[model samples]
Target: MTSEAEGRFHIVDVSSITSGSQRATLRTDDGVRIEAVYEPYTRGVTDTAVVLAHGFTGSADRPSVRRAAKALAEHAAVVTFSFRGHGRSGGRSTVGDREVLDLAAAVRWARERGHARVVTVGFSMGGSIVLRHAALERDTGGHTDAVAAISAPARWYYRGTPSMRRVHWVITHPMGRLVGRYGLGTRIDNRDWDPVPLSPVEAVPMIAPTPLLIVHGDRDPYFPVDHPRMLAAAGECELWLERGMGHAENAVGEELLGRLGDWLTRR
Candidate 1:
């Protein structure tokens, strides 16, 4: 949060352009322009690519997402982009609904760049969107080799969220109202989408056969450690529950690169 630009964006120049990294604009169907970072030669000679999807209110420039991208780049081409209404991507946010579409576009974009094996990594709400996107794509005949959900709130909000008053957490966060006011998203739309039905619990079933890795911080205040377990149980997914870790603590430290590197390499 060191820098908050007009677009709720920030960037960490971790690598040089000479590193063969390129930044470009990815146009979405809704006309919002998403900022994308492409790091080729990650896998050296693999036809695979990894897409890193940051959580709610997160952008590609966020240190966590950037680091994940760089880490995975060691295994394959890595692409990280911002969700609409977040960062430089178009219009206001649509919660996770339209964000699913954004992931789809990014995947296709990566495929065109020579990625025959596509892997998606989503954190928090980004995980939710990844599940929904992969599900929708499957229903439509598109294919994804693997999809991972990390520390996602895979249950419905507005139900029994005594913790953090999860429903109100979404409804009252100032930024939430701000996005609604700007027509970037809608408050009522959340009511229409049940977390349980739309959550990893529901989405995990469809991802079976395709590889999945569910990572979670055992001490996560927002999502239970068992969350990842449940997500994995639904499909043939591997589970990684970090002891004493909470939420997205995976974004930092040596473990970050090692864990993500291993995951992308497996894909």
Candidate 2:
């Protein structure tokens, strides 16, 4: 990659393929270098851009994320990026806390790239980030035209499920952090969330007037149907309880992706 300084952010150009796809390094306002890929629409012409955020341990290059990006790109331009500490990105993961800045950087980049409308679609940890970012950064340049969160938790520190319990251990224990780093290729932050950031349930209420969609699987192993129900109750939005779906990107099928693309296009 060739790096070039651009004001407060840095960009490392990887490749610009003929398919209108390109890869680059994006520097968040917090100074974290994020690895990102942009894929232009393949099926039709559109002014919308979808900024796709992956779940924990996922990066832009991950197969599931790539599949979703390719599917969404059929409707509009797509931008997929690694949260800090994942893939080729620099810095440690804050889980979902400071990751807002990372999403903000991506949204800003999307606007600068000439997309008239920008939508944020996130899964799992990313789902919460998109919820919080849409609410907290509404006045900021990071504001998105619409938002969609798949398989997100409604509240914070939920340990009702076994998966969440293990997640907590990974975030709170040193050994688990090591496992996250080496075993999962994810580097987690050692510290806890001080003062606690705004939770997704609270953020949902603030996203009114801006279109919001909450998608959750009825068979989600991480969080039950109550999660999406809580979010929908808090916000005036659409809720889709995906039958038989599991969790996050892994469970997303082409049909669901196509429906999500159609929804974003309408907004």
Candidate 3:
């Protein structure tokens, strides 16, 4: 909320879209450019806003992100932004480390726009960032009304599952980063965390008394049920476990998205 520069449209296709939404580029306090879109909630709703953070390799324009945003917009204003390095933003990704700054910037934007209450909802890597961001924001005396973290990992360096191992390879291997940069449009950092950042479970304790919802799927290949259990225990919040849900945004259906929007509205 302290400092940000509004940016104009850089892509014609996105600019030509006919939705009743506002698009702008946001500058993070650390100086990263974040591509974002804001969709005001329907008139009769209360003054609450939801900020969405997408998973790794996903952007604000992704169909899944837009779908979730549209669903949430039925109840509250929605702000969806691509984390630096993932979309048209300028910066290499440290995975979830500096991404917290991206979420913080978006949350501040929501507050600045006159939303009395702000709820952060994140998916996958984004989910972890939301948990950490809310905790970090509160530690600095900032306000975050509520948070919903879905399909997030409790701890880092987990490779118990084969899919996760492959993802690790994609993120850590040289050729993988090449493919990520070119093929997937994702730029990942090749450096290690010198001073380890707070794990998702570690960050949960600090978000106390602020509403928190932990949602995970039993069938997620990236993370087992234990991840959500660990977060639920640490945060002492409600956990919604879907029976056959897979992972992140892909696994999220429209019905669930609406329910999550309702959940945030009620909070």
- Compare the candidates by lDDT and give the number of the best one: 2
Is 2 or 3 the stronger prediction by lDDT?
2
Give per-model TM-scores. 0.79, 0.95, 0.92
Every candidate's CA RMSD: 6.3, 1.8, 3.5
Clashes of each: 5, 0, 0
**Model 1, CA-based lDDT:** 0.68
Q: How far is candidate 1 from the true structure (C-alpha RMSD, Å)?
A: 6.3
Residue 10 C-alpha lDDT in model 1:
32
Sorted on TM-score, highest at the top, how do the candidates line up?
A: 2, 3, 1
Residue 112 miss distance in model 2 (angstroms): 0.9
lDDT of 2 at 237: 93
Give the lDDT of residue 94 in candidate 2: 93
Residues 1-267, model 3: lDDT tens digits: 122343422312243432556766777888888887888786665689899989989999898998888889888999899898888888988899999988887887787777888899999999999999988898442357889999999999999999888889879999999988998899999999878899999999999888999999999999999999999988668899998899999899988888899888898
The sequence of per-residue lDDT tens digits that candidate 2 reaches over residues 17-56 is: 3266777678898778888887889976778999999999
Q: What are the Cα lDDT values of the candidates?
A: 0.68, 0.91, 0.86
RMSD over all Cα atoms, model 2: 1.8
Show where candidate 3 strays beyond 4 Å: 1-15, 43-45, 139-142
